[model samples]
Target: MKTNILSLTAIMVVSLQGFSSALETDAPETITSMGQIAEIAHATQEFFWQLVPPMDDPLYIHPDGIVRAVDWKKFKNKDFTSQMTAEMKTVSSSMYPVYRLTVIETRTGELLWHNSLDQLVWQTPAPLDYNPYFFAFEHWNVDSTEALDTQNLLWGRSSNVGAEILLLPEAFMESYEEDVALEAEAAALAAPMAMMLLSPPTVTNLMLAIGVESNEVEVGVYFPSGYTNPVDVFVCSSLMDWDWSLFTNVSSVGISEFTWIDETATNSSSHFWVAA
Candidate 1:
């Protein structure tokens, strides 16, 4: 009877492992550059179906249920732009899913801030419901014609760390919250607190070396004296009960002009870069 039970347990374990493997999407050979990343974004055919707004000729209700008139001819058979767009892209490997966050200045086409996540998904079969991070890049100058600063809050599941933990060193932790002062003027300044989770060893290690606490859910990360206010500080994940009104303490001085874009969700479509 003992032998029979042991055999059954071993079989079940193998079956579960196989099932997990089946769920993984293999990573492409390379996904390391902006153009490559953009190609992946373009490859997502479903998103481009909207195309240019129909020419004014026919009448149709938009997906929003608004009545509209347009020429369907202008839209029909319209080829998708082979060129890359400044949008986020997602791809996965056998072990983990990767995310590419990109920011570009529309007027100058200057790449301001770009970051990628390749191995951060510590848990097997990466979490499916990661929330979108709030990015405020290029908010440095009022006209956005000068230098740029980036603040990206990435959220993902990690087997080695707890979710919503700040992982900054002890000294940094004490002053972390003071650096990021939310501007009151940006009426839409409110963002979801759930997006601040950080769990990479590299980020935590640097924080520890700089003298901050290792692993605790953090409200924000503060920069030392030399860095400028607003642009200098970056907020990590915050608690659910955090006070939104506290943003009034500091002002962005009208430098808060940026947008937050969510990365593309995963789909079965083959994710590969197509040259422009």
Candidate 2:
């Protein structure tokens, strides 16, 4: 039939070239490691450590009670995201650490001191409610010496960027029975809070200013969610302006500074802090 109509038109041109190569496709996209999920992004809730201090290994205290001692070592987060494999801490932390002590009177709500297990280890993950004019007193003419020089303008802006603290450093009263590095920094502030947050505040714990000097900051409150209302937590380190009360409002606001991550190699890997 003319060679069977050219073999039935070569089998209908190889079945329409296998149906137009199966409707033209590339077929790529199968990579996945969707291991961790439950993402609601923007984190950093619960963490209120009153008058926060202890960047690490400190139990030191001595407005004069005496107990000079020392020996310890060191330590991120934000409206925090944590894509940690199958692990995390976007905020809901506890690697384990608790041990507290308070010596109030930063300007009333006065407890003025504690010890003998500080009324059972101070315990205040919540419930403080402060406000003795909640810092920097936002005008009634902001007294308390401009509300402690506006909370010593946070270590004079910690490297500086001011509105007024004018070079923070003037209250290191040495005679706490003759200082031994302030009795090894008040026996390193009673140690806990995960080992005083790995120690790193030394502009000199000055305060009670006579020359506008103050340092010994460690404030926290960051809530960002959970039906909102905490207010960027910081009263005596200036921030929460505008006359709202209840101890410097407090919720959160971060990004202090300092970043290295980790290090080791020095075969031109290099490190020198400043060694003459």
Candidate 3:
């Protein structure tokens, strides 16, 4: 829920002179100077408070898929290696599962996007106890250079917040029809049903906060004082009804890109998964 430190609204569109270049001359230190880059067989990691290619960064990028990461300002100096015990490492790696999204327009039958496969090599878990704000060192970044491609999207873990993805939203969004009769017909039949569904549900008081600075919006989780081992929280969101032209096969597995084979259907159905 924190800004990379769990924000998703940072997504924006930008001009790319080259499909393979990044304006990282000033990537958040946690990603460049302050963060350590580890070479894994499959994944390369990026640690940052905010990334421009996806964030509305003046440093020059709105890359495509910018999700969240820990706030580097707090964890820039943290020793991630020292925070792990065998049990935590096992839970973080084997127990946690990375879940990618399969976005198909429920009504139009169009496949907006999907990450066919995903993998994570747990580098460091959030220092929830001490950082207090769920700050941690570098999370995960795809090592593949193809990530820079306008055709692909990137995903990362926010500071103890949750998994996030970054990408420039694509075209399918222009679905507005000017048929006034159609709109009137739909609206006429929905007023009564909507009123009945407005009943309130019960729940405990849970606090949430969102801060927007330099065009970056960050959402964070807060627990009541004295609360220990807070209950698990889950959230999932996406840009629906827009951009079906974006391909999200992040792991470079099986097929490098998405190709729709069925010509009869107006859209497609894709397979996506994540390895936590």
Candidate 4:
């Protein structure tokens, strides 16, 4: 009886060990792939583009047809989180440091979105950090059709912190509307229409302080940089029907400054002026 009991105990112990070995053989993997990280980065960009309104939306427009300044916020949430198995962004470290990104809208100059990922174990070696990058903007084409600057992908890095970035709007103007406002103001002042006299305003070669109407186009003449003398101006219109001779309100605000409305040059697309 004693022998039989010992034999049964031994069999039970062997059975339990075998079952544990089977479980170990069927264990699930915990590692992630580099491709998976890239995919997540891609998805993050698409997700971000959906949050903001288009560039031409009236919210961004000012009364003067320039873009207004506004703050950026996520559509549904103030903050967001994502998980990615990214590779090491740094060259020396084999350890992949997950990055936190603060995305700014270049058009509005607002911090619109932010996201970060926590590190994960990998089965296969992952290459390159898969952080999100997004870029968006409006395209101004000579024609009415929409344009795209698809040459480069959106990316940013601090090198020190290993942070990356994403741009939104898919297209960007060379300058923001606010930037345009400042540029237009400066251009109008420097233009020939703003000249007060044909000579330097001051011995220090001061900039002329004459008034410049934003609506009028100033003809450009090749004069010395400090010279402010007025030069003859000529105008052109893209519209074949525009008649410059019919304008009767030719007027001057300064000694040689002159401005006239080419009534037929109604749209910006049709009006162009230069020195005669």
The candidate scoring highest on lDDT is: 4
Give RMSD to native, each candidate: 25.9, 32.2, 24.0, 29.7
Better of 1 and 3 by TM-score: 3
> lDDT for each of the candidates?
0.21, 0.21, 0.24, 0.27
Ranking by TM-score: 4, 3, 2, 1
List runs of model 4 lying over 4 Å from the truth: 1-230, 239-256
lDDT of 1: 0.21
Model 4 residue 27 distance off true place after TM-score fit, in angstroms: 47
lDDT of 3 by residue, 42-98 (tens): 121123323312322111111223211223234343443122222111111222111
> Candidate 2: lDDT over CA atoms?
0.21
lDDT of 1 by residue, 1-276 (tens): 011111111000111011111111223322323344333322321222122112222111111111111222332223211121222222121121112232222111222222232112111222254211111121121333122322111111011111111112123322322222222113125532222322223211211111112222222232333433443212212222221122113333443322222121122121111000
RMSD to native, candidate 3: 24.0
RMSD of 2: 32.2
The alpha-carbon deviation from the true structure for residue 166 of candidate 4, after best TM-score superposition, in angstroms, is: 18
Q: Score residue 227 of candidate 3 by CA lDDT.
A: 35
lDDT of 4 by residue, 1-276 (tens): 011111111000111011111101111221133332333333444433322222222111001111112112322222222332222332122232323333222222222323433232112222344222223232122221123332211212111111133221111222332334454567557764433222223333322211223444322222334445434443444323323332232223233434333344334443433332
lDDT of 1 at 73: 31
TM-score, cand. 4 vs. native: 0.17
